[model samples]
Structure formats: structure tokens, C-alpha cells
Target: MSVPVPKGFSELTNLRSLSGFPVHVDMDASNSWCSLQELEPLSQLRDLTLYGIEKVQDSRMAEKAMISSKRHLQYLKLNYSASGHTIGTCGAEAEQQQQQSVTEEILEKLCPPTCLESFILRGGYVGRRLPDWMCAPESADFKSLRYLMMENLPCCTQLPDGLCCLPSLEGLTIKDAPAIKRIGPQFQASSSVAARGSTASTSAPFPKLRNLQLIGLCEWEEWEWNDCEEHMDVETAIAMPCLERLQIKNCKLSCLPPGLASTKRHTLRELYLYELTNLTHVENIPSVVKLDVFDCPELKKLTALDSRLQKIRIVCCTKLEVLEGVPALDSLVLEDPTMDTLPEYLQAVNPRYLKLDCNKKLYESSSSPGSSEWDKISHIGKRDINCIEDSDTSSDGYSEED
Candidate 1:
């Protein structure tokens, strides 16, 4: 559409920065764009946001705009919102095919220069798959790609195959891909070994990936550890050598992937798992210093907590019956209303802070003068129950602050 610039805004012909150019097609013949052709003159544009991509016309004029030719562009966000006429409508199969074709062509032709440092795909992409160029060929190595985030892509069954091949990539997030039932070999950096710019001696899929977030994957039940059965030998497995922090939220998986659960295999130091109803256990990641579990109803036990763990938070886990072997634990937070009692082992260890944030039933028992719960938790230096606290801070938790 005609994004009316501030009368003379276009006159800043030498401007190095321009932002917020919304593109949308009015379904009713009432409104129309002046064509994406006008953007060709903005030679100095370095950042762009293209919204309402699904609304573009079928003639593919927008594709011919050749966005990738903008050599100086460093950042871009592509937003797509499905139109009224989609796969769910009558005679859907044919209409869906046509739409997918148009979407793929539009994405394929809108290539960004290799200088792009950040890319974001926001909103819904009903197309079942993404265009190939989302992850450029290995020849380019995507040296400047530092961050990538894709969300609301419910119809896409798999992530871009070459996504992690970028040697410079440091952060990644994938959200709300409900149709993705499994994470297969395509996700591992070693799957594209030769293209990783590394010798056959070593392959790092996410060489620089330090932080990762996976959220709202409703149907993802498995993180396939052995996708390439022919090469399933331990030697060919890929590890997250650089990943230090990871978070998984609202997923349908019943267990943690072997890579993220083993400290010997991954470099993860911080982990958070939330709302995973099917998960039954948490264990084996000894490198993690901080661990948090929230709203996971099926998780019944925490086995082999790392000796390096300094802080732990467990909330809303109704069936959690045990926490084993955490000698280095410095702080413990049991905020779940379902926990009627503290673990008996917690009475001996001393920590700087012990927060018991349960409902009135447990909180009252801890507050009663001669109660067993109150006596057991007395060793903790500082105590806060439902926001009320004892000011006696513990030297154990204080000196070991992370």
C-alpha cells in the first residue's frame, strides 16, 4: 500500500535509516498499493519490516522487487497473516496449493544480502514448508547471521534444514510449530557436516549458539537422537558445545533430549523446563548450575541433581516425591501449592535462602510453634513463606552468590 511518508521523508534520499513500511492488499477492490516497485529508490535502507505478506497479489510484482539485492540491508522481519480464503475453506486443496506456491515464490525472491545480522519471522505462515534460501548455501557460511527467530508457523512441519549451519549464529528461537511432531536429523549441525566449514575431524552445527528457546511446540513428542540409523554410532552424534543456557516451555515432549540432559555431551549450564505435562523425570545434566521446573504435573522425581547446582526452583509439581543427591545446593524454593511437606533431607543442608511459598495448609504448619515442618526447616538461614520472612540471612547462600 502507499505508505505515506512525511511529505519530504523521501527527500532524505541519502538517509541511511528508514523503518516501518507496512505492505497489505485490500481484499475488496477498495484499496490497492502503489506497488512494491517504489522501494527500489531507497538505496540507503538498512532495516526493513514487511508486514501482511499473505495479502500480496498473485501476479508476483512484490517478488520482482528483489529485496535481496539491497546489499546494505542488515536486518529484516517478515510478517505474514493468513487471509480469509485459506486451506480450511471449501475446495481447499486447490486454493491451498496456489497460495503455497505464491508464498514460496515471494519468499524465494525476497533474498536479503549476506550482511544481515538478525532475521525474524513473525505471525502465522500457513504454508507447509519454507523456501530454501532461508538458510543460504554453505558457500556463504552466513558469517553475519547472529540471531534468528521464527514463530507462529503452525502449518510448517519442519524447521529450515540448514538453519544451524551458520558458523556465526549465536542465538535461536522457534515457537508455536504445532505440526512438527518430531525433531529429526535435519536439526543437528553434524547432519550437514561437510557444509559446516569445518574439517571432517570435527563438526559443530551451532558452533556459536549460546542461548536457545523452544516454546509452544504442541505436538513435538520426540527429539530424535538417532535419525540417521546408518550413522547412529556414538562417534557421529553432534553436541551443543557452546550452548550454556536453554529453556523449553509448553511442549508436549515426555522427556528431555539426550543431548540437553547429559553434561558430558552438552555444555549447558542453565536449564528451565515448564509446563511439560508428560515429563516424568529430570536428571543427568551435571553442568547446569541453575535448574527450574514449573507447572509440570507428571514429573514425579528429580534424580541425580548435579553437585554443581547452586539454586533450585520447583513449582506446581504435584507428584514430585523425591529430590536426590544435591550436596552443593545453596538455595531452595518450593513455591508450589501442591507440596504439603518439605523433603526430609532439606533439614540438614544449610543455604542462604529457603523460600516456602505454598498455600495456607503447609505455610501454617511451618509457622506453628511446635510443628515438625517448622522444626525441620529451622536450619535454613533465611526463610520466606508466602512473602513473610525471617531476616536472618544465611552466610552459606550469601558467599556463594551466582
Candidate 2:
């Protein structure tokens, strides 16, 4: 796996971008691997990416690379390719430990400069643990990072600590990280230390985050704060206190981070859920203005829909029968709704616009003059039943039902 860097790479002193370097250590003492230290001369690098990091075994050499010297760099991506390796046997396990130890040291040395604004780590790291440098709230100026993405690290049991809490992070996306089961205060410990006992109120994690997405986490079950060892009281905890939008898709998580979930009461404005079959109940969301649920066949009810929730679009949620909290909704859009019966309080929602994306017979019984649904929706000024079209797009289909 030891690949030598081109002999003249260092001579490219003015390189503005460099990527796909494969530096490695060989089993023979006679063989030589290119040292990462060669990159220090590329001072003008604005974007740098390192691929095949698992092959680099000389931790000291990596440490001397001085990646932090590139003050002009704004974007960095690190890749580790462990493609055909298997960790099934004793010998393989030992080798992983050795590789990871050196990898961790190299990563520690390759910390990006404070001016870095975007970072991505795409890997299939099967090592027992990730490098310590991945953890955020580092002594380094990691607060300058605005956009963060971690993808394809399927065996990574936990995400980097406090990643969501970065003071300047505006967009965060985590995909294909199957091992992450929870994201709570435990992950934010490193950054929370300074605020531990101070009574002075501080900004919460995800304070400036506007968009947060979690996808393809197969083992995720809960995001409950009561399950963690955090010292903050839930009633006062302002986690994700400034979040504007959140999306959870293709995950097995039946629940959300309690701290993040609590923010729905006042901070969260929009929520989108898709293909989360195990997610059956959603309650206590009092402030969400736009809520969209799709293809979650197991979801039987919205246990508590906020009274002021302005709009809701439900698609293919076959088991959902109740929408208890939406007593004052302004618009209701349904497509492939499986509920055989509607909530008794349907009249209370009093939606001015009701659009049903079905075969027009959806409310056959209720469409009649004396039916309860007729009485329930008769007050709606705008109602329409359009044939279902695309599943991914919205269907306003607002026709005046005279």
C-alpha cells in the first residue's frame, strides 16, 4: 500500500489545490514512503484533500507536515480507504490497532487552519475508534468551520464530539453512519466544559445551525436526554435553541434527541420526516409551522400536533388515525392517507384549505351531505381531490368547492 509521492511534488510551491496523495510505509526497511511534510511548502493551498490515509504509517512524518501552516486554505477533506481489508481474525485486529494508532497521530498533526470554513470526512473506518482530532471544540480554531459533512463511515459508532455544537456551523449533514445511536450532551462534553457550572446563560449547541440532516442511520433508536449523563435540566436546556429546520430520513430512530426535540416547542420552525417506519408517535411539537411526513407507514398518529401549526402534508402514512394537536391548522394536504377514520376534532382544525391527493372517493361517506366529514370539512372554503401524482412534490390542488 506504500505509494511514493512524486519526487517533484514539493517543488510545486505555489499549488493552490492538491488532492489524492497516497503516502504509505512499506514492510521493507529499504523502501521509502513520501512524507506528508512535503506539503508545508504549498502555502497558497486553498483546498487540500488527502486520500488513502490508512496507508500512511509514519505518524511522526505526518505530524511534521504542518497542515495548519496553510492559512489560506478554506476547505479540507480527509479520506481513508480500507477497501478490501477484513478485521475478522486476531492478526487482522492487531494490525487495525497499529494502523489506527498511527492514523490518529497523523490526523492530529493535520488539523486544518483556523480559517477553514468547510470540512468533509468520507471514510469506511472500521477501526475500534476514530482519531481524536475528529472531535470538534478542539483547541484549534474549529469554530470557524461553517459547513460540515461526515459520510460513509458506517462502523463509526459515535460521531465526533460536539460536532453539532460548533459556534459557527450553519449546515450539518450526516449520512450512512449506521453505528451512531444517539446524539446528546455526551457528544458535546468537550465544548460544554467551560459552561459547566456557570449560572450565566450561554448559547446552546447548534445555536446557529439552520439546517441539520440525519440519514441512513440503521441502528438509531433514540435521541433521549434522560438516557445520558448530562448535568443540565431539560426544562432549562436550550439545545439547538436557534435551529430553523430539521430533517430525518431513512433512519431507524424511533425518537429524536430529547434536547433537540424540546426545541420544537419554541425554536424549531420546520420538520420533515421520511421513510422512518419505526417512528410511530410525534407529540409536544408546539411551534413547528410547516410539518411534512412521508412514506412512514408505521406512524399511527401525531400524538400531539401544535395548535398553531400552519400547514401539514401527509403522504402514504397508512396507519395514522389521529391528529390531536392540530386544532387550529390553516391548511391540510393528504396523499394516500390510510386512516379509515378521521379525528373527532377535525372540525376544530377548521383548515381553510383541504387538498386530498387521492382518487376522489377518499371521503365518499363524508362527501355526502349528512356525513360527519361533510359537516367537518364543509366550512373549508377551498377543497380539492386531485389524483395522486409525484410522491416527492407537494400537491396544493386548491379548487373552490362550492
Candidate 3:
């Protein structure tokens, strides 16, 4: 249910927090039901959210809100109503261009205060480029911003390059953005850093960022980092110096970025990959202590030379062949009902504890003392294997047959 604000709601000038303030407009009427001008006097706001931003008639009206003037403001969220527009169904090209222009202008005028610590942009933003404040030179305006999330962007083709330069940013998430196809070197360093011809004095990109996630970017296929020798010296440039966790899901990327694996090899601790249909290999991440892989059918090799790696979990990765280079592995878990035999990697890597969720045929072979499957896992200190019976009424299409 939508609640209506009273006629003089802005009269309370002392309010410090506000959320989900809807912008209501009547296209046929001479006057809008609610206008952003109402917020001009509410200068004490410390946190705010504006919903239905797509209904704002023009950039001038948004400028009246004076969001940047609220020095006390620390959090902001701007949400666009879902537009239900996809690639070919957005009507004529001219109309699309007009819509994009209006959206871009409105966002530019709604820049947040410099003290803002967290910001979120949600729904179907159709702009080809992000707001100017989100780009380089202007991005320095957000020196206090600590976190940012952009979701359900239907048309933006690339991430903001300025994000890599944020001095205080710690977490970032970009989800359900289908139009982003590639992440170039610009995403790792600002263009100004490149203009100087050396990174000797330039601070590392993402200096404080610790957690990053990329999900549901189905069209993404490439990430170029180490290949950008013309932009910066790859050997000398440092990035993501404090990163601890990274997750990639439902993307088409064929491999992890070489620069990321090389630069973050000492700071990155956990890696997670899921439903990456085109990914073929994961290798050389020497700092990851935990690795989880699921539903990546095309993955063929996973090699981490890190002595710190202690745990691994793999599920339904049908084509995986080699798993090597973890000398201190403590536990391994494998779950795949379709697999008829133990993976060949088990013969090369010896984990202290092994857990298997397999079908009846595999359990039968492994239970026999003299069988090859039994010989392979007999060296492990502890083992737990669950065999499921083939059946139509089971929860996973198989019932436990203990």
C-alpha cells in the first residue's frame, strides 16, 4: 500500500530520516500531485530515499530538491519504477533517445551530498551513461562513500570507471545488468592515472574495497586487466590490495581476469563461482583459503598453489577434470547424483576428510574393500558417503537408501 504525504508534510523541517518518498505526477493536470520542490526546506535530512523517480517531469524539477546541499545526509537511495522495456521492445529509436536523455539529466541534477556513506540505485535505469558525478574527476566528490549497489540496470553498457578510485569504498555489487559485455582496464584505474604515464605515485585502485560481487550479467564475456600495458605498467600497478572475498555467478566470462589473479593473489581469501556456463578454468589464486564451485558444466581445471587453502566444495561440475596444487587441503565435499564414478582428481590430491553425495552405483563400488573406488579413498582419515536410491518420489529425484 502507498501512503500519501500530507499537504504540508515538509513543514516539519527538523526531520532527520525519510524513506520511500514517492514522486507523484499527473501528466494531464496543470499541477503535479507532489513536487520535489517540497524538499527544498528539509535541509536537516541525514538519510533519504526517493521512489518513482521516472515520474519526475524534468531535470529542473529535480534540481529544486537540492540533494547536494544537505551536508548532514549520509545515505541515499534513488529508485526508478520498473519500465518493462527490453532490447527490441522499447518502441521507436527517437522516443528511446528522448527517454534516455531525460533520465540522464534527472540523475545528474540529483547528486548526493559529499558526506553520503552508502548509496543504492535500483530498477530499470535506461541511461546509456551513468550520472556525471559517478564518473572521474567528479567522483572525487564522494570521498566518504563506503558502499554502492546498482541493480536491474537494463541498458548501461559499462561500470563507472571512477569507482576504482574511491578512497573509502569497501563493498560493491552489480546485479541483473544484462547489457554489460566487457570490463576493460578503465574499470581498474582512472584515466587520469593513465595520463601520467606511471603508477609510481598513484594510489592502488580499490584501495579499501573488501567484498565484490557480479551476478546475472549473462552477456558479459571478457575482462581485460593485465593486457592493458599501454595504460599502465601491469607489473607495478597494484589493485584491490585489501580484497577478501569475490563471487561471480550466472555470467559468460571464459576465465578470471589475469590482473585480478596476479595482483590480488595475496589479499583475496575466498572465491565462489556458480552457473558460469562458459568458464573453462580457474587457476593461480595463491591466497584463497576457501573455494566453492557449482553448476559450472564447462569447467575443466582448478589449480590453486596456495598452501593456506583448507576447504573445497564442488557440485554438478560435469566436465571438470583436474584439481591440483593445494598441499594443505583439509576437507573436500563432492555432490553430484549424475556422476557414476569418483573424480580422477581424487587420486592426485589427498584431503584429510572426504564427503560424497553420490548415486547407488558409486556407493556400491566404494564400499567394497578391494574395489578401485575403495582403494582410492582408503587413505583418507575420515569419510562420509551417502547413497541415494533411484526413485520418482524423492525430493531430489532420489531417495536415501540407508
Candidate 4:
């Protein structure tokens, strides 16, 4: 059997399955034949990924093609810089100008794309604000959208207000967006939205949201509900009732959001904070079953965690001096400890499985295995560990430091 290559996609009126169509668009110069306007021919496409678009002008044509195919599109990923499009690294003003042009083109061509469950915009000149139609529940055709990721958009500033309307939205990630200093306006507990309408509606809360990740945000100063008020209280804001996991990396956040405590320690099950350099506070890690903090050199303590915390892994915090409050934890992993000995209180936690490696203190303690209280509930060991510092280790029982 021979696989026949159609002379050019141009002659085909209806190609049934164009797997990996625009994602790796057969941009082999001579082979590039799918007209940008006639993508509807691939009517069965459930997933469409576009990658490495070099020229900025090509994106305008591609945007139109995406909108046209939205009806059958379940997953859409637009990656603009495999050719290393320099629009992102250029000065903010130049990037802004390009985004404005791109935004208008996308907006004009966009008609509520339906059936989309996940939409991702990666490495391109995205405008400061996403179009209103994209955010509006009434306007968007994607009723089942569960994941939305926007990465490396240098010009984007805020999330759309219609975020609350996404009934199925489970995960929202904003990464490498240097200009986005805040997560929400009306969504925050304290905002002007409360004054104009029901405060309850503004804080409708992420009923299905399980994971929230913010990374590489340099200008982000604070994440508090009712930031406009003189004080933000955790007790007032609605909680993330279903949130189970949280991961923050390389973001210069001063501390955890103040309203997280208001969640009443009800839903949070796993927490990972890494490379947060200026982080000085760790007040509320509620009912967390697993916690991994890595490469946070300035952290002075791991504070306010509940007794139910089951697993704790800490690495390379040169200044970490205390782990006094965590209790009822089943597993304790300490690697590359900053101090010569484990914190005095850590020896007393009730973890059933304990692993220690590479730290001179834990290594010394390994010889005198029965000397500490941790020996009662845990199996302590001294071993050489090898793993990447930034990789996620939650599933295999390991996490990277920073």
C-alpha cells in the first residue's frame, strides 16, 4: 500500500482529517497549499495547533482561519515564534504597536468560536486586553472551555471580566506576562464591582478551578481581595471550594494572597512555591496534604501550616530557620538543609515516612538514627539524591528546589 500525497491541498475541496494541520503547517515552501480561508474543509478537526510562525503578517491570516474552524475545534494552540519572532523582546512600545495591529485583525475576524474546551496563546504579540467577546459568556461560542493559558504576552495587562462566566473553567495560567501585575479587578474581593452590583456576584468564586499558576511576573506586588480598601480580610471573600493544587514559580510575590485563609482550609490539598526570591511571609497553607518549597533563599520560616499537612519537602533555603507549626504530617523530606542540624521542632513532627539526603546535618543524624523523635514514626536514611532542581516531582515523590 502506498500513501499518496495529494499534488497540493489546494485542489482538494474537502480533506477529512488534517491531523496537525497548522500546528506544523507543511510550510515546506512548495508543499504549503491549504488556503488560509478554506480551513472549514477539515471539518472533523478536534485539535489544531499552530507553531513557529515567523512573519508577523502571517498571523493575521491564520487568525481568520482559526475563527472559521472554531465550530469543530476542541483544542487550539497558537505558538508564534519557532523562528524566534523578535516581537516579544523588542521594546514595550514597539511590541505594543504590533499587538494593537494584531488585536484588531483577530477581533474583526473572530466570531464566537464554539466547541473549544481549551485555548492557548503562546509566544506572540498579544494585546493588553483580550477582546470583550472572548471574555463574555454570551458572546463566546466555547461553552466548555476548561483551560486557558496565555504565555509570554509582554503587552497583556489584565484578564477579561467574563472569567467568572466560564462554567467549566478549571485551570487558568498566566505566565511570563511582565506587564500583568494583578490577577483581577472585579474578581478581587474588594473592588469597584462590589459598589455597583451585588458583591456576591463579583466574588462568585472559582467553583471548579483546581489549579492556578502565576510565574515570571516581576511587577506583581500583591494578590489580595478588596485591594482598593484600606484592609483586605480573608473572612469576607469566597473560597476556592474545589481548588486542590497551587504552584507558583519565579514570581516575585511578597506573600500568599490574604484571602486564601478565608477558604477555611477546606479545599487546598497540595502547594508548591519555588524561586520566590523576595518572599518573606508564609502565613496560610491550609489543610495542605503536601507542600514543596524550593530555592526560596530569603524565607525565614514555614509558618501557619495546619497540623493535617501530610508531606513537606524543603530545599536550599539558606536562611530557613524554623518548621515549628506543621503537625500530623505523614512524610517529611529535607534536602540541602541550610543549617547543620534539622530545626529543633522538626524532629517532633508525626510523619510516618521520612527521607533526608545531601544535608550535612541529616547525614550526621543518620548515623545516630534513634536519637531523634522523628525516628519513632519515620524510616530515616542518608542517601545521595540526583534530580533536576526545577522539575516537578509531585507524582514520583520528588520536587525540584527553585
Winner by TM-score between candidate 3 and candidate 2: 3
Clash tally, candidates in order: 3, 1, 0, 3
TM-scores of the models, in the order given: 0.84, 0.77, 0.89, 0.74
Taking the tens digit of each residue's C-alpha lDDT, what string does model 3 give over 113-231? 88999999997777888987887767766789999999888888998888886779999999988889999888887434732233445567777889999999989999987734345
Instruction: For model 3, give the 10-residue run with minimal summed lDDT.
Output: 392-401
Q: Which scores higher on lDDT, 3 or 4?
A: 3
lDDT of 4: 0.59
> lDDT of candidate 2?
0.68
Model 3 misplacement above 4 A: 27-33, 83-91, 190-200, 227-236, 388-402
Q: How accurate locally is residue 221 in candidate 3, as Cα lDDT from 0 to 100?
A: 95
Which pairs in model 3 have colliding backbones?
A: none
In candidate 4, which residue ranges exceed 4 Å CA deviation?
1-17, 23-32, 52-69, 82-84, 88-100, 107-112, 136-141, 185-203, 226-239, 263-265, 359-362, 369-402
Query: What is candidate 1's lDDT per residue for 108-145, written digit by digit as tens?
Result: 66666777888888777777887776543542356798
Q: Backbone clash tally for model 4?
A: 3
Candidate lDDT scores, in order, read 0.70, 0.68, 0.80, 0.59
Error of 3 at 13 (Å): 1.1
Candidate 2, residues 186-231: lDDT per residue as tens digits?
Answer: 5544345433343455455555677888888767776645323255
Model 1 bad stretches (over 4 Å)? 1-13, 24-33, 82-87, 135-140, 191-201, 226-238, 262-267, 343-350, 387-402
lDDT of 4 by residue, 118-232 (tens): 8787766456666655554442244588998878776667666565555577898878878867765444322223223333443434556788887777676666553222333
